[model samples]
Target chain A: MPEVADPEPLPVPLARAGDPAAWDALFRRYQLPLYVFVFELVRDESASLDLVQETFLAAVKHLGTLRDNAKFGSWLFGIAHQKCRQRWRQRTEVLFDEIPESAGEWEPGPDDLLIRREEEAGFMNLVAQLPPPQRAALLLHYVEEFSLEEIARITEAQLGTVKSRLHYAKRALRKLLEAKNENPA
Target chain B: MKTPRELLLARHRAAEPKLDALRREVVAAELNNQATREQSFKVSLVTSLLCCSNKLWRELVWPCRRTWAALAAVWVVLALVHLAQRDGSPPALAQSAPTAGMILTFRDQQEILNELFADRSVPAEVVRPGIYAPKPRTETVALLAA
Candidate 1:
C-alpha cells in the first residue's frame, strides 16, 4: 500500500500590522463570524454592518498595538463588544422591530437549514428579552464560541461576573423559549 | 431541558455570513475611498501652498521677528542708498575717508614738518637717498586718467 501524507494545515489568517491587504484578508476570513456575532449583539443588519466596519477600521488603525496576532478573532470581537456598548449607551432601546426579512429567506445547505434558522431566530428573540449583560454574555458564550475567559476579556467583565451573567442568561433564555413554545406564538 | 446556549450557538454557525461577495465589495470600496481621500488631501495641500493668504506667506517666509527686522533694515538701507544715488547727491557719510597723513601732508606741510621735527631723533638711517623723493608724475597721471 502507498503511504499517504497528511494534508498541511491552512495558515491561520492574520493581518500584518498596517497592511490593508492583510487586514482585508483577515476581514474576509472572519467577516462572517464577526458579522454574525455583531448581528447577534446588535440585532440589526445595518447597525451590525456599521459596527463591524467601525471595528475593522479601529483594528486597522491600532493593529500595531496588538500584542498577539494569533488572537485576532478575540481582539476583533472585543472591539465589536465596545462598539455595541457605545451604541447601546447612545440609544436606550437596543431592540429593533425591523428584523431583516432576508434573514429568514436564506436557504440552508444540506444541513437542516430551516430548523437551524428557526432555532437561531428563536434563540435571538429570547436573548433579546434578557437584560443587556446577560444577553451579551449569552451571545459571546454560545454564538461566538468564546471561552468563559475570552467572554470576560471581550466584555471587560470579571470572570465571576461573566459566569454569573451566563448562568442567569441561560436560565432566562430557557424560560423565555419554554414560555414561547407553550404559547405557540 | 436542552440548554439554550448550546442550541443557539450550533444554529448560529449555520447562519454565519459567507464572506465571498461582501468581503470583496466592502474591502474594495474601503481601499478606493481611502485612496480618493488621500488624493484630495494632497490636492488641497498643494492648493494651499500656491494660493495661501498673504499674511500666511509672510508668517511662513519670515518666521521670526528678528529675521523680519533684519530684512526691513536691509531694505531701508538699500532704499536710502538708491534715493541718494538717484538724486545725484553725495553720500551722507563716505565709508572710506582720506587718512590723516594724506590730508595733513597735502594741506598743512609746515605744521607736519614742525610736528616731525619735535618728535624726531635723527640718525644715519635718515640720510638714505630718495627716502622722501616725490614719485614720478607718469604713474600719477595714468591713475588720474583711469
Candidate 2:
C-alpha cells in the first residue's frame, strides 16, 4: 500500500484562533508521536487514547497562553505529560517497566513500520524501564528530535536537570542492554 | 515515495496504530467544538467596543499597521498599569475617619465604639478638650456621623 504524504503542522496562530482545519492538521502531525510518548508513560492503549484526547482538548483551551508558535510540539507533549501524571495519580498499580519477558508476535498491521527493526522493540522495552523523567527526556531527544532546551521547557525541569536525565537515562539503558545480552534471558 | 522529508513523515505516520474510527471520532469532535464556538460567539458590548477600537486605531489613527499595533500595545500596557496602581493604592488611608483612629480589627473597632457610646453620659468636652465640646445629643451624634 502507498503511504499518503503528511501535511505540514498548522501555524500556531491558526490553532490558537480555533480553526478546525488547523486543529486537524495538528492532530494528524502529532498524534502518532504523542501516542508513542504517552503509551510509554502509561502502558494501556485505551488510557493513552483518553490521555491524548485530554491533552489535545487542554491544548485547545489554553492555546492563547502559548507565546511561541515553534514550541507547539513541546507544549502539546507537556500537556500529554500532565495527563499521564493525572492518570498515575488516579491509579494505584505501578507498571512503568513491566513488558512481558517473551516478545509478542507482531500482528500484520500499520505500526509495524515503527518497530521494523527487532532492536527497536528491544530499545522500547529498555525505554520503559527508565524512570519517567529520564524516559521522557530520551524520547523527546531522539524520537521527537527536540533540543535540550526544548525538553527542559516541555518537562518543566531546569536545563541542567534535563541534561542529566538524558545522560543518566542513556547510561542506565546501556547497562540494562549489556546485562540482558550477558545473561540472554 | 515523494521527497526524503515526505518519506520520513510517512515512517512517523506508520507509527500510528490502525485507528480510522478513532481518528474520525476525534475529527468529528473538533468539528463539533468549532460549531459550538461559532454559535456561542455573541459579541458582548465590551468585546464589540474593543474590536471597534482596534479597527479604528488600525484604520485611521496610525494606519501604518505596525506602528498602530505598537502604539495600541503600549496604550493597553499603560491602561493596565494605571488600573493596577489605582486598585492597589491604600484607599483606607484617605477614607478612614480621624475619630476612628488606630483601630486595627473590626472587633477592636466595635469594642472601642461600644465603650465610647456606652458612656453617653460623659459631657462631650471630657472625651477631647474643645474637640468634643458640650453639645446637645443630636449635634454630638451628627458630628460623630460626619
Q: Name every residue pair that clashes in candidate 2.
A: none
TM-score, model 2 to reference: 0.52
Stretches of candidate 1 above 4 Å error? A1-14, A93-121, A173-185, B1-22, B29-146
Lowest lDDT sum, 10 consecutive residues, model 1 chain A, at A99-108
Give the per-residue lDDT of model 2 (tens digit) for B71-110. 8899999999889879885777787675644545766979
Docking quality tier of model 2 = incorrect
Please, what are the lDDT tens digits per residue for candidate 1 over residues A130-172?
6777777666655555678888888887676677676676655
* Chain A only TM-scores, each candidate in turn: 0.71, 0.75
- Give the alpha carbon lDDT tens digit for every residue of A99-176 in model 2: 222322212222222222333446667777777777877777655767778888887776767766766776665566
Question: Which predicted model would earn the best DockQ?
Answer: 1
DockQ of every candidate structure: 0.11, 0.08
lDDT of 1 by residue, B34-127 (tens): 6888899999998887777766767776578788789999999999989879799566577578888988777788777778889556676776
Chain B TM-score of candidate number 2: 0.21
